[model samples]
Target: MTRQSISITAPNDHWLKAQVENEEYASKSEVVNDLIRKARAQQDEIEWIRAKLIKAEQSGFTDESPAEILTAFKEEARRNGDL
Candidate 1:
């Protein structure tokens, strides 16, 4: 494992200390690493949604009603195990 030397604000440092005291994490390093992992995952999800939106936009306007479109989307999500 690589060692890091970084500074954090008082509030952020306090939060990390609290996490360790609460036994939610083994150490500040673990808390920071878990947060980084979550942030990376969130970014990936955002990129995926952005790609999907771009594809939809490029497909042009649709004649489907809002409700119909939502239902279809939900059905597709279920089929893909996304919902």
Candidate 2:
């Protein structure tokens, strides 16, 4: 575990205090760590989505009919045990 001293301003300081006072966090460090964790997770999701979009763009369009698409979707759901 690492300990560091950092400064925060007015409303942000109040927010941290409120989080600890409200028992949302055991300490201000917990709040900061949680925020960083959430931010990193969101960034990861954004990167995943970007990669998917690029892959789809590179894969080009499909010519399958709407009914065929629906059938394939249902088959996939069944295969995945989602149906």
Worst 10 residues of 1 by lDDT: 63-72
lDDT of 2 by residue, 21-82 (tens): 99999999999999999899867755665665555555667655545555665687579975
Query: What TM-score against the true fold does each predicted structure earn?
Result: 0.72, 0.70
- The per-prediction tally of clashing pairs is 0, 0
| Candidate 2 similarity to native, TM-score | 0.70
lDDT of 1 at 30: 98
Whole-model Cα lDDT of every candidate shown, in order:
0.80, 0.76
Backbone clashes in model 1, listed as residue pairs: none
User: Which parts of model 1 have CA positions greater than 4 angstroms off?
Assistant: 61-83
Q: What's the true lDDT of residue 7 in model 1?
A: 94
- Maximum-TM-score candidate: 1
lDDT of 1 by residue, 1-83 (tens): 99999999999999999999999999999999999998998678657756655566567777555456556766886799765
